[model samples]
Target: MKVTRYTKADAEQWDAFVRASKNGTFLLQRAYMDYHSDRFADHSLIFHDDKGHPVALLPANERDGVLQSHGGLTYGGIICDESMTTPRMLEVFDVLLEHLRTNGLNRLLYKTIPYIYHLNPAEEDRYALFRADARLYRRDVLSVICQDRRLPFQKRRARKVSQAQKLGLVIEASEDLEAFWAILEANLAAVHGVRPVHSVEEMRLLNSRFPDQIRLHVCKENGGIVAGVVVFNATRVAHVQYISSSERGREIGALDLLFATLIERDYADQAYFDFGISNEQEGKVMNVGLIEQKEGFGARAVTHDYYELSVV
Candidate 1:
């Protein structure tokens, strides 16, 4: 086995591997990872077997002697294909730890991809982590709706949808990101006291790069945008990356209407609908109201876990 540090020249190979990996997502693609290159000192790695065939890839960055699987991404770990077996993954971790130790890195922070993202049953990395004595550092709850076995919306949410329909709210694909960003900015500041992770320009750039994968859907009334959601479309899931509404939008239940259309019409065929995480303070805090809103839409829980490994 051999491990190689990633370089610009590896972009094409890396992207191809990610597309074929059972647990990989667009976030692992070089294009997406490189967007915030100026902020992180990338230390991504690619693994190869004795026959010189690539088997696994790790998207990571280093800071203060600690390596994070990927700080910019929501979740990232060793990306592998269906061919990766338990024993092979264990070997991969052995090599990974050795490489980290040799490189003067003392710790590793790994974020496991949620099971919903996998194209196949791929949890070999979890066993490998256990073998390496990695500790679970955090766990976040994501509310998701399984398409085939979806639960009916709660009474309050059902009423909201009816109210939105009576108000003549129209849910449709939208290209007006600037207008939505204003609402998102205000909503986050007023509610969470924080700003959107991506600036307007950054999101627009990403949208341009992955137009098909990233989309904006909005609810409008009288030709004016009132509520919107930025969805990141993966192969098996449609994830709500950002959701917000104007004051009038909330009164009329624009978000409820928008989500109903997304889950029941636009992406009805998708396997899962991810409402993203509602946890704060590194998973130690749960925002009850925020999670309740998602649960009311018939979504259930999925946990996203983080692990810490000492490279001594």
Candidate 2:
């Protein structure tokens, strides 16, 4: 395999390859990855077979002599199509390391795409990372509900959903996201002292770029927004990218109702419904309260991994 650095000219080829990859999602597309190009020093890569057909692509960035498999996104790694096999992946990793070494980057931080996101088995990179002796640096557990085999919500959550239903909280898919972003921003600021990674404008731009892939579902009370979740749709997954509710919304269990509805009816067709991660401190600390809420809705643990490699 021959390796090449990604450039703006390769956008079309990169996105087409990502779309066909077994493990890649729209998030790895150049349109989505480059949205925050100003923040990250893009050093993403492409791997081609001897005939010059792209076999794998890595959505990555470099800074301070290190390369991250994209710091802007939730998770990423080597994106490969059906043509990729274990033996070929071993060579891919070898070429990948040499490419990194030649570029004077000595270390690589790789974030693996969770299995639920994969359209097919695509863990060859995980094996390659092990062969390269990559260090397992971080592991975050996503609370996910396997829709077809989903369990009923806990009694408390069920009661809340019932109560919220009586409150007449109307759920609708919205094209405009600013109203929901305001609620999300306020809730995050008050509860976590942080802001959402994507601004309303940025999110709107992305939604416009991938309208069918990204969606905002909001719960409204008497024509006012109370709660909402931004969902990123993948091959067989419906992942909650951002979730938030107003104080009054929380009081009435608006989120419980929202998720119950989404899991039970709205997104029931999706193979898995992810509630995002409940860990902090680089996946070292588990937020019991946070995860318990997801578990109450029949969500179980699915770990997302991060690994480090010494290329030199």
RMSD of each: 0.7, 0.9
Report how far residue 196 has shifted in candidate 1, in Å: 0.3
Using all chains and alpha carbons, the TM-scores for the candidates as numbered come to 0.99, 0.98
lDDT string for model 2 (192-259, tens) is: 89999999999999999999989999888999888899999877899999998998888988898888
lDDT of every predicted structure (CA atoms): 0.94, 0.92
Top lDDT prediction, candidate number: 1
- Tell how far residue 149 is off in model 1, in angstroms: 0.3
True lDDT of residue 208, candidate 2: 92
Candidate 2: residue pairs that collide: none
Global CA lDDT of candidate 2, please?
0.92
Candidate 1: Cα lDDT at 136 = 96
lDDT of 1 by residue, 84-174 (tens): 9999999999999999999999999999999999999888999999988999999999999999999999999999998889987788898
